[model samples]
Target: MDIIKNIKEKGDNMIYILDTANINDIKKAMDIYPLSGVTTNPSIISKENRDFLDILKDIKGVIGKETMLHVQTLSTTCEGIVEEAHYIRDNVEGELYIKVPVIAEGIKAIKQLKKEGFKITATAVITANQALMAAVAGADFVAPYVNRIDNISGSGVNVVNDILNQFELYNLDTKVLAASFKNVQQIADVSNLGVDSITVPLELLDKSIEHPLTDWSVQQFTSDWKKTYKTDKIIIK
Candidate 1:
C-alpha cells in the first residue's frame, strides 16, 4: 500500500515545528529549514539558565513576527494561569500561543483565556479525554506527549488518532500538535495519521532527511561520473 498516498487522501494539513527555546538552536534550525514555530515548557526554558522574559524576547527576535511562539504557563491554578498568560503576552510580542496543561484548573483556565481573547494551546495531554476536554474548552491546539505516553505503555499515535477523530466528529477548531518525539519513525507514523502539527527536536529534524541508501547512491553516481569525465569539479566557464 502507498502509505504516503493514503495519508494525502486523508488530507495534508501537517506543519513541522521546532520544540526548543535555545536562541542558537533556533537560529541554526531556521537557517536550515522552514519551521512553522517554536515551543517551550518550563523544563526547556530552565536548561537555558537565562532571564525568563529576556530569553523569550530573544527567541521572538530570532523567529521574528511571523512564526508562532508557544510558551507554557507554570501556574497550577486558574487565576494564576490567566495572570501568567497576560504576562507572557505583555512580554513576548508577535504571534503567540499560550500553552496550558490539560488538568482541572487548566481546562478552567483555557475557558477563561479564550474568553479574554488569548490563543490557547492545551498541553501535557496523554489521553483522548483530556484532548477532548481541551477542544471543548476552545483551545487553538492540543499537544499530546508522544514519547511520554509510550513510556507509560500507551500508544501515542493511537492517542493522536483518537483526538483527531473526536475533532472531526464534533467539528471543533482545535488542531493536534503532536510533541515529545524521540525518533523520525514516530513522526512518520503520526504524519500518516493526519495530525495537524508536530514539534520536532533539531537532531530528529536532521535525521529525518537522511538515509544510508540515498548517500550510497549519490557516492556511486559521483564515482562513475568522475571515472568517465576525469574531474570532480563542475566548471561553468
Candidate 2:
C-alpha cells in the first residue's frame, strides 16, 4: 500500500486560515490556496475603515457558508461578552466562530456559549495552563501568540509544544491555532510541532511559498528551451 502523508482535512488536518480583514487579500488567498477560514480582531477590522457589519458580511460572502469566520469580542465582562456574541451571531450569516480572550471573564463566557451550542475560539493565550483551561471550558479552539511570546525572550515553539502536550495528556479535543507571527520561519517552527491550525498574515504567508530559486529554475528551463527550438514549445522538428 502506498502511504501518503499530506492529506489535509479541514477539521482534522493542519488548517490554513488567513488572519486578515482586507477583502482583497482574503479573496486572493482563497483563490490560490485551500484556505480553511479567516480570523479578525478589532485592530484588523479597523484597518479597513468600513462599517463593522459590512466588513463581516463581505468576508462571509467571499468565504461562503462552509468556511468559518472568527470574530473577536470587545467586552471584558462575561455578561457583556455573551450578549455581544449573541448580537454578532444574529447578524452574521453562516458559520461564525466567536473569538474570546482566554481570561477570567472569557472562560465564563465560553462556558455559557458552549451550553448554547456556539463555536468558540479562545484567543490571547500565552501559557499552556491558559490553553488547557480554555479547552476544559469548552472552547472549540485556542490561539496561542507565537511571536509575541518570542518577543519577550521565550520560545514560542516550546510554548506551543507545551500546550499540545497538556491537551494530549488530558485528552482534550480543542484545536490549537497558532497566531501572531513575525516571519515565515516562525510558521514553519510552529507547524513542526503538529499544531492543528495557523492564522497567518497574507504578506508572510505569500512569502512562505515563494523563492528566488524557483523563479530562477523556471527562467533557466525557458531559456534552454528557446535556444534550441526558437520558441518554448512541445512541437519538435
RMSD (Cα, Å) for all candidates, in order, is 2.7, 4.4
Global lDDT of each model? Answer: 0.90, 0.91
TM-score of each: 0.93, 0.93
Cα lDDT tens digits for candidate 1, 1-237: 222223233555568799998888899999998788999999999999989999899998998987899999999999999999999999788999999999999999999999999998999999989999999998999999999999999989888888888787787878899999999999999888878899987989999999999999999888988998887656845
Compared with the true structure, model 1 gives a TM-score of: 0.93
Highest lDDT model number: 2
lDDT of 2 by residue, 1-237 (tens): 122223334566778999999999999999998789999999999999989999999999999977899999999999999999999999998989999998899999999999998999999999988999999999999999999999999888888888887777787889999999999999998787778899998998799989999999999999998998799877767
Worst 10 residues of 1 by lDDT: 1-10
lDDT measured at residue 215 in model 1 versus the true structure, 0 to 100? 99
Candidate 2 matches the true fold with a TM-score of 0.93
Model 2: residue 11 alpha-carbon error in angstroms: 11
